[model samples]
Target chain A: MQKSTQAGFWKKNQRALAPWFFMAPGIIMFLVYVIYPIFQSIGISFYEWDGLGPKTYVGLQNYRDLLDDDSFYTSLKNNVIWLVLYLLAIPAGLAVALFLNQTVAGIRLYKSLFFFPFVISQVVVGLIFTWFYAPGFGILPHVINFFTGTPTAILADDKYATYGVIAAGLWPQTAYCMILYLTGLNNISPDQVEAARMDNAKGWSMLWHIIIPQLRPATFIALVVTVIGALRSFDLISVMTVGGPFGSTRVLSYFMYEQSLSEYGTAMGYGAAIAVVLFAIMLVFISLFIVRMLSQERNA
Target chain B: MRSLKALAGLALGVSLFATAAVAGEIVLNSDQSDPAPKKAMEELIADFQKANPGITVKWNNFDHEGYKSAIRNFLTADAPDVAAWYAGNRMAPFVKAGLFEDVSDVWKDNGLDDALKSASASMTIDGKKWGVPYTYYQWGIYYNKDVYKKAGVTEPKNWAEFVANCEKFKAAGVDCLTTGDKGGWPAAGIFDYINMRTNGYEFHMDLTAGKVKWTDPKVKATFAEWAKVVPYMSANATAIDWQDAAALMAQGKAANYVMGNFAVDTFKKGGMTNDNLGFMIFPEITAGIPRAEEAPTDTFHIPSGAKNKADARKFLAFVASADAQTKMNATLGQLPVNNKATAADDPFIKTGFTELSSAYALAQFFDRDAPADMAKAGMDGFQEFITHPENIDAILERLDKVAAKVYK
Candidate 1:
């Protein structure tokens, strides 16, 4: 009788339980890795802890310390610079995609060639740029020396180091955006473009009024990736300047790693505070992106 | 059906066997990923197993940089029976946290007190030894004879002559001092030598220990002396690695590099022969000060939570022996901390051994001596001072601010 009743319950709920059973792995992962850590990080930000030792609750001390910290302010400023400069990838990617849109003899080869930087790793790009700007021996410095008679090591100078790292980041980031735009370009309707051309719309007007609207989804994804990329600008800085020329090139993400996980860094609580601030900044743009994505989904 | 039952039986047997732990095995974690150090470790383990046949060692070797952070994690989680670390303030965090076992008994029983006396001060905190120091290497001014000849200057005997030679090197369009602070420890070596020369080792220790203010007049005096040499340092040094700076000296583009004995490898790899590569003690600044040299030590410790403390202590004692140290240092190309142990026959190691032994006192290098946070801030200040010597007051003030918080 109990087995028959249990079987009846299973038969009744099978349809409702099936979707949840399928989603259990993803739901468990999200809770464990993403949701729990965010709260744990926030909890840790109130304490003073070295990773090896006992943690002491200091009650907002880490954030209070950040207010007076020049390095903190420097990182915040550099992150702003990264966010602003990194967006240039979108327009630059659009330009490259527009140029590559034509049917040429060996167009597939040219498309893959343009996509080369994206296929390679960010570390390789950083290393290539490091060699290019290396003073006394690097090719770029040699060329600059030929023109100006004074060789400048851009990564060595605090004033220009962030921009130099940003330039390296932009190389691969632009290539990625170009690939997205090229795919979006492929799905553009020939009939609409033909109609726009018939209406005397060409070049800039054609792009502004007709073609760009078709590429909206690609532009949205590019913006999302670029914004997140700017927020998490760590690897290039780590490989290139290491947040140096005395910490001038530091952005928030690199600053957090330097404070917590680096060889000399043991201020775990302070690092968490930096992480919270970065998360808060990211939340603003993330919410905006989400709202746009949701509204677009509804519209579609 | 019969085949399926056999497969299930096999899987269960494999699982049961895999779950069983070895009875007399001890695990050791160390960062000796380089060829020489890894081979030395392997030899040490083989020799140890041959001597003590009842026990076995399971070693986990990590890359150098990764091990620094990994130690903190593994010490808290699955503690190793033995761990490789550094002496001095580098080990202080583990010691204070009670993660490291008090191996003072091992030291006493093994007579490491008199044998490893050169490193005993660095190994001790709260009047108890936390680990056994196996090896150390000295730091000093390494220069290029070719560059010196080109600049028309001989090796300086004292601070005045060193400063005067900087002028000549400047006139000859060569950097008198080449150091890369990208890793942020090389510049600290320069600061250590200058501070030890200017105010003495005691004052420098007090300063790093946070008893003295960074803006103290004595500290300012150290900076004043540093300011005299800053103009002759390599341009854009912050962008370069220590290896790059060694390349500068090897290429004869720079005259003097304040570095550790280990950098001799990089210099040799850069096509510099021992004939043209010279090692000298940093010149005397305050003439009456007793010479103090930097010789950072490598150590091994048993963790407090280690399951096999008996075998770990035995391993520590074995590592402390003169024979073991001699063999290990021969492979490492470094000076063994055990007084009776012989260093490698390499010229750089010989000079390091002589200098370390003869000094009035030995210090761990600045980064190892100072607390990590302070070491980083101090190195950054020194690097900035190298570039903008005029910003001395501001840099010192910033260091004082950090010291105020860190020591508190």
Candidate 2:
């Protein structure tokens, strides 16, 4: 009788636990690579070492040093600018999605061409912009000369270097967001749209009251990606300016790399400190997102 | 089914045996990416393997930037049996941590006493030698003779002449100098030159070693003089690299480049010859100010836990040998660190060697002379001063604080 009881229990629970067993590999990988290093980096922030010899404990010293670092302030300010400007991608993406959602002839080809920038690597985007901003013979410089009678090198000037790089970054990011919105639009219910039309609602009002609510998931994903991309903007800065023109275009990620790993930089402890600070700043947004997601789950 | 199972088991057994047999190879880490260096090292390894008969050498080569981060992680874990590294304060911290093998006996046996006298000074920490000198290159002003002639100016011999030439070049509608500040170290070279020329070599060494302050009058004067020449630099220099700056000189768009001798290859690739390019030692600031030349050296080190220490030491001795240095530098276009090595057929290298030997004193370039942390602060100070020359005092003050923190 006991054996029969155990068999019945196993039969019921095995199916339920199968999904989790299948998830184990992914969960372990995520925990090992993504979750653990973050905590380790934060812990290392409170010490000083040159990646060799003994580590010295220096509580709050690195943070205190940040208070007077002009580059840090410039980076923080540029990060804020990047975050604000990056949000334009969402609305711009939605507009493009709406335009491309029709089943016209060769519409697939149009969508693919529009999505080409997103498919290309960020390194290529940086190179393209670098050529675009090249001083004497590049297209943008020639255009500027045509308009203002004086050619301007966007990357060489400190005033425009950050914004110039951000514009280049935004080109591909906007396309990605557009493709996501297009997918979301394709899944919208035709019955709901017909009912909204029957209620004399159309155009902007219909989009606001009915169709827009359904795009919440798409918007959430877009916002999350944009924020993360803005925070982790190292590659574009590295390839385009290398935190140059007097360190005017330095973001935290690039600054950390410059401090820790460059030929002239071996301050691993200070770099880790910067990384920890950036991670902490990113955590606040992540926590808010998690809380919202959890509340939505509970409501469902 | 039984036949298939037997075949699978046999294959698995063979694979496992092959893996086990191949696990004893020694890995070597290097940062050289040029095909010539890679081929040269591979040939050397093949020769070593032939000599040893029982060991294998595996090469792990990384590009310049990739190797910087890779070395840090590799040293902490399973480091390679041999690696390439920079000399000076860069190697001191590693030596202090006992991460490098003491190759004193090997140095003594190889008759490297005269071959590596300069490198020995840079490699020694607390009276222990830790590395073998490989190849080093000289850094100085590389000017386009055509541009200088067009500007009606000659290569400057002193500070006054250099400034006058800069004014002449600017007046003649040419950029007097071109350097990339993207990495911030190129500008730091100018700062090092000014400091070394303003004060003596020992004083410049003291400044980098934390024995002196950043806000010292001598340091301040270096920036002051640098401000006078800032406007004459190429307008779009910040967006370029050292290679691009060399291209400008090759194209006859820029008057001069203050860079290292490694730029010889870039110039040659750009179709510029030795006749089109001229070399000059950085001029003196005053009659008594001891001028120090910037010579960046590359060296090889054997890690402490190497499995084949004898073979690694043999490789080191071979690298420092006169024949090896001559062959390597012939292809590398770099000045051999060994004084006895004959100059190659390359005219650029021959000229560079003559100017290097004629210099009053040879100081390992600024980035190597200073600790890495201090170098960053100093370079950042240089970039700030270059961009906003009026804020020199504020920049120096900030650097002074950073120097205090790092040096302490």
Candidate 3:
């Protein structure tokens, strides 16, 4: 009787419990690596620690200092610039995908050439851009010198350093988005396009009313990745400028690492506070993305 | 019966751990991953082992970045008997955290107090020696003689002559000075020399120790002096690396570089030979301020948690000796920290030896002398000043704000 009852309970609830069993590894990993560290960083921000010496509790002092910190403001300004400028990748990517979508001789070769930047490591991209803008010897400065009679080392000027790094970041990002859109273009329903063409819809009208709506899923993924990429734009800055020309190119991610983990950095509490602020900024967008996806799921 | 057997095994393990340190064996941990430093380390180990045959060294080598993280974690958990680190304020955190052992007795017994006299102050903290400095390298103006000839200028003898030479170089279309502060610390080298020369070494010591305010008149005076040469510096210096600046000097594109002895190899690699490469002490600013020089030191320390403290002390004393340092630095291509030790017969090394020996004080460079936070902030401020000399007051104010927090 006891065996049968146990068997009956398993039979009844296994359907509900089976998915959780399948998700156990991922869920546990998320809880440990993601959720726990977020709280741990938040807790650490309330202390004065150098990762070597004893930690002293200083209750929001790190945040208070950030308010007065000029570098913090500079990093924040650069981050906003990155977010706004980085969105250009999506539309730019769409244009490229559309341009390359048509069947032609060696179309795959052209598509791969467009995809080359993203295929290479971000470090390589940064190095290429660094050489491209290097002072005196770089091609861009030489060209600028020829045209305007003033040689411009784009990475060196504080006014232009962030934009220069953003341009390097955009190369890979645009390619990534292009691949997404290309795949989306392939999956567009032929019947719907045929119907739209039958009504004499074409060009911008066809793209706006017919193609883009079909590309919504691709657009969503591109938006999410681009936003995250912009937020976590550390490698290019590290390789090209190192938050230099008087800290003009520093974003919050690089700032956090500089404060806490770089060769000269040891301010654990301050770095943690910066991390918390970055997380809060990310949380707003992440929540919006989650909400939109959930509404769409419900509609589907 | 099985549980009892397990208990017996656990007891045996505990007893073995207790006796391990006393078994005539010592473990040495270091991050001398470069070819020269690694070979020098191997030779030093062999020599130490030969001298003390009864004792053995178990060496665990690590790469540079990994060792920095390892030393901190390993010190508190399973530290080696001897570990490689740096000197001056760079080692202060470890000393303060009780991560490093106080080796005052090692200094006294080895007569290192007299032998390594130039580095004595840097190795000491709270009236106790924390480590043994083995090697250091000098910093001065490393100029291209060919560039100077091309510009029809001679090496300057004093501050006025230096400024005059800068004008001559400007006329010749050569950058008077070149430096890249992208990694940030290179600018601090320029700041240190100017500050030390303008006021004195004591002022630099106090300022870096945070006893002096950044906005003080004396600091402004230093900045004022530095402002004269800012125009002559590379306009794009804030974007490049020190190596790039060195290349500028090597290629005859720039007239001078304020750099360390290590850059000699890089210059040589760039096809600059000894005859065309010139070294000179920075010209005097305030005439009577005792001539201080920068020579950053690298050292070895024993962790407080080290198991074989006796062997570690022996290792420290051995490294501190003139013979060991001379031989080791010969391979490492750097200056021996010991006053009695002979530097390599290379012309630059010979000049560096004289420069350091004659100095009234030896600063361990700005980044090493100042706390890491202040060093980084001060260097960033220096970089800004290099680009925008007009922002001196703003930079100083920002530095003062950071100093207020850091010093507190």
- The top-ranked prediction according to TM-score is 1
Candidate 3 lDDT tens digits, A1-300: 999999999999999999999999999999999999999999999999999888999999999999999999999999999999999999999999999999999999999999999999999999999999998668999999999998889988999999999999999999999999999999999999999999999999999999999999999999999999999999999999999888889999999999998877889999999999999999999999999999999999
TM-score of each: 0.96, 0.91, 0.95
Sorted on DockQ, best first, the list reads: 1, 3, 2
Q: What DockQ, between 0 and 1, does each candidate earn?
A: 0.72, 0.55, 0.62
Better of 1 and 3 by lDDT: 3
lDDT tens digits, residue span A164-235, model 1: 999999999999999999999999999999999999999899999999999999999999999999999899
True contacts kept of 1: 0.68
**What ordering of candidates by TM-score runs from best to worst?**
1, 3, 2
Native contacts, share recovered per candidate: 0.68, 0.68, 0.70
lDDT of 3 by residue, B307-382 (tens): 8898889989999989999999999899998888889989999999999999999999998899988888998899
Error of 3 at A226 (Å): 0.5
Worst 10 residues of 3 chain B by lDDT: B15-24
> CA lDDT of B383 in candidate 2?
71
Give candidate 2 regions above 4 Å deviation. A1-23, A191-210, A261-264, B1-26, B42-56
